[model samples]
Target chain A: MASMTMIPADCSSSTAATTRLLPMSCHKGKALHFSRWVSLSNRLTASSFPSLSFKARASSPLISAKIVIENAAKVIDGKEVAKQIRKEIAVEISRMKDAIGVVPGLAVILVGDRKDSATYVCNKKKACEAVGINSFEVHVPENSTEQELLDSISKFNEDPSVHGILVQLPLPSHMNEEKILNAVGIEKDVDGFHPLNIGRLAMRGREPLFVPCTPKGCIELLHRYGIEIKGKRAVVIGRSNIVGMPAALLLQREDATVTIVHSRTKNPEDIIKQADIVISAVGQANMVRGSWLKPGAVVIDVGINPVEDAESPRGYRLIGDVCYEEAIEVASAVTPVPGGVGPMTIAMLLSNTLSSAKRVHNFR
Target chain B: MASMTMIPADCSSSTAATTRLLPMSCHKGKALHFSRWVSLSNRLTASSFPSLSFKARASSPLISAKIVIENAAKVIDGKEVAKQIRKEIAVEISRMKDAIGVVPGLAVILVGDRKDSATYVCNKKKACEAVGINSFEVHVPENSTEQELLDSISKFNEDPSVHGILVQLPLPSHMNEEKILNAVGIEKDVDGFHPLNIGRLAMRGREPLFVPCTPKGCIELLHRYGIEIKGKRAVVIGRSNIVGMPAALLLQREDATVTIVHSRTKNPEDIIKQADIVISAVGQANMVRGSWLKPGAVVIDVGINPVEDAESPRGYRLIGDVCYEEAIEVASAVTPVPGGVGPMTIAMLLSNTLSSAKRVHNFR
Candidate 1:
């Protein structure tokens, strides 16, 4: 294990300026300085020590000593954790089928020919197959009417064999997205994009039948990695319906002191630096720099942006909202771009399908 | 005008201990002390300067000089503001009625005979009358079946003349609150307790046809006063589905960096002292004291609890979760008990009903 480098004394001078600008009289002697590691360490329990997420540190000689000395965050292994969840879902599905002689099923309605949409649909189908759940996909043409899409959703809603229904987003330009989503029966709304499900998610003591997959994946990663969310300060840097907003709501449900920093927010960097955990889904690659992060922050990056990479075989490579190179040094733990939330999304969809099946069939 | 009292130097020692206990290295040199008035004075605008809501100050010259010299918060006059909004609503209702031959109507379905519930319903009916919106009432016996209540809601849902429907909360234990609330049509859900409306409120860029009244009133208070929510740190002290949860969500929509402090939260006072604004809805009398407030912080007390008072004619008096005496000296602005959020809730309910009517009739 590498001995961690101490944070330089002048790292928090910018925050000192912000403190001066605040109207509250209590804004002095509490601006965060990286030099105060002693008090920080005292506040954390042994289980929550930043080094726990670094399981690959010993085996991966690719990790540089300089980065390691700079307090490299433990890499939250989302790929591995997602695989574990899929295995559990498979077992549950198998047990339910054996007990009731019925297999779980998912129905996907994808409109238009967007490359990204097709790829996502294909991935979902493959994932359902991997877990032995039946997949029913309806691919309407790009020029299809809203009525045609609603009819397909109606068919899935009425079919007892299909326990889950998902309408792929970025629907055709002419169609009303809300109308189409609301058309899906609440029981079959495994995508959890329906307003009712989201409402249930927002209310205390009320559980949504399904949580939106991507945000659920983010929380699942934290849970799988044994990170404590309750009482911790969390900053979510986006307010998108599918990811950022739901992510913030879910964090609040888990009792994290959650703050959302969107496009209109001022002093975002200053706010982000105060979080014990940071979830960035702003879709702007490398928007979160090293300075934006509090030292020892656990970061879950949900943004997957494509950046030009001439060296790669493909025309471009995916980069997350977080500046990985910069964040890895300051954070206590981080989830990588491609492998972090992406795999977990598919896993959650499968889990939702399994749960829906169990619920409908009473095969718990 | 009575002189405001100055806060003592040693008022925030507990916060100092909490500042020392934070795990984030960024927590340094920012502990609040009430003695610092000059910096606080520099941050406030003219309209927002303390004393605006202090309507009782002149009449009650008994308000001590020591307390007056201490920074007295700008009093947020919810009663006065609600009155102005009601007047505006009256004008709108008249114009709509004259043009469209239809008056906005609100239906209240009250179950049980609790004195408070009766008073609330009566007040609502009176408010509707004042605004020239027709009022319809349906009172069910406490022993009525869920079906009976549902039947009444269904009738109002189908009534074209009724633009809004509210089922008084704390329905008999035998009835399912969720089931009955869901029975009200989404369009008529002016109380904004419906899952769909709440979901819309939670989603970014999506608008709820109606927002929950209490929370809406809280936001309206801040807006009418020109208190900037965007980029400010706000602490909502509670997570009730009715008030605290939605209030936090609404504040987030306004781009405030919002943190919800609940029962499980650690060092709530310390967390609260950091906020530029604090909204307390925990229902505990005087739980939020002057020491818990950051000097120049804006306080919104949502809790309305009755404490036994031998001197009062009723032998009890209503109080807020915040200790008004202490907070008035520390905050930049504060909403007083009885006249604060109480008046605003009904104002918001009327506003919601009026908006729903206008939306339905295309009167706007």
Candidate 2:
């Protein structure tokens, strides 16, 4: 384990002042509330690394020697794990084909001409092909009517070959997203964005027909790594419906004491510091610093923010929510920015598709 | 405000022993966990009031004199609150009828002949009449096939006048409950048991068409009492589909830092003692005691367990999960068993019916 360093008190003073300004009152014995507030206040005071003076000490021989003393945290290797899962899915697909003469099929409905949306659809199509699952694609013009999109969904809904349906998000501004998403048959909702699937996920004792892909991937990573979630404290930062909210519910279902830290959370760092597992989906680049983490905590960073990099040919570099250099020292293990969570999303989508096909065909 | 009494430490030793025997570890600071454990351990240790020498004290005038020093807690007066809400609902019903010439209609489908189920249906019918809403009832025989029940639901689903539909729970052992519940149109699901409604409730920005009655009633009581939920620490006991799970999700929606303690949770008392507000829906009688509460915590007890009381003609009395007599001394305000959440459930059902009618009619 790498040695943990404590940030200076001066670096955290502003945050302490802001927290004090917030309207929160601790009633009763100051013993419990007072000590807790003090500890949280200490952890949240600094916004960035206190030892960031390394920028000025870059040329110094003494500073360079100090960095050699620390050991790096083990990388989570999400890309490798995702590949292994894809292989397993491939085996299942081949077995289903042999037994029932059926191939798992996924239909992707792309409404607009956004570059990112096109890229995502292409990736999903390729992923389906890689695992021997049939892929169907429907592209509507940017100026297409809502009815046109719904018509495509209806066609997919009635198709016996299509086991799963995914409607790319952020449908044109003129269309109601909920209406379009809800139009997809619940049985074929592979993305699991349908309200019914989300409700089942939140509920206890009721199993959702499909779990949301991204959050499912996060849990799958932890499971594959042999991490024990039962009875542990897990914190999910950011409560976006697609990732954070479902992730928290999934953790709770696994018997972990889960807490969600969103924009309204008074002392997010304090609440986050107590977690045995931390999963951050907030898109802010490098928002989580080493000081915010508990020693030896496992971190899964879902944010993939692009920062300007003049040296790169693309003139940009993608980084996660956690400050990688700092977190590597503080955490026991962590998922790398580009390789982590990204690949797992597609793998989960494939997995949901496979499960849907098995259910439809009554194939084990 | 009631003058609190401190119970003897010896009374709570057994519960403390059980809690200690459970596996729990606070990695860093044991002091915080220890203090919290002490407080919860103190409450759980005592099976009953420490001064249960009441039989012997009745004959002694000096012992009776000591009782005068203690004060009683403020009663929540749920009956009065329920009455007030009914009056408001009645006014709205009359106003809507006068303007639009249409009254809100609620349809209830009850299966089997369980005495308790019959009584609940009767209460719901009476509540609808009290608020001048139309009441429709469908009683299916105990051994009716699933298709027969589905046919009845389809009839109600097509009825334009029916604004809300509630299928009384605990269908025959042979019937599939989820299939029957899902058959009710989401727009008319007043019970809010549908996965879509639950999904909407769990998500951050989505609005549930109807909040689940019991959990909605609990939140309403807190709102009526001017209890602040945002940023407060809340602990919900149990994870039942109907109450505990939804209650925790509702609390989180209200921005309270929520933790759910279920059967699998270790050291539940230690986790619960830190809550500024506690909502317990576990069916166990007297599961939560005075010591488990924070000194000024507000408690909402949803459990209605029946215990034998030979003096009564009915041979039984209803009690809440909390040991009421002890809780009144520890908590700032507490809801009574028969009057507390029971009346609120029907009130919320009426509220949901009215809202559904207004939504369908496009009336404010």
Residue-wise C-alpha lDDT for candidate 1, range A221-280, written one tens digit per residue: 788667889888899998888888889889989988887888877778887987888999
Compute the lDDT for candidate 1: 0.78
Which lDDT tens digits does candidate 2 get at residues A3-53?
122222221232332111111122112223323442333222211112222
True contacts kept of 2: 0.61
Quality of candidate 1's docking, in CAPRI categories? medium
The alpha-carbon RMSD over the true interface for every model, in angstroms, is 1.5, 1.4
Q: RMSD, each candidate, Å?
A: 11.3, 13.1
- lDDT (Cα atoms) of all candidates against the true structure: 0.78, 0.77
Q: Quote model 1's TM-score.
A: 0.81
In model 2, the runs with Cα more than 4 Å from the true position are A1-73, B1-74, B308-313
Give the Å error, residue B6, model 2: 26
Worst 10 residues of 1 chain A by lDDT: A18-27
Q: Tell me the TM-score for chain B of model 1.
A: 0.83
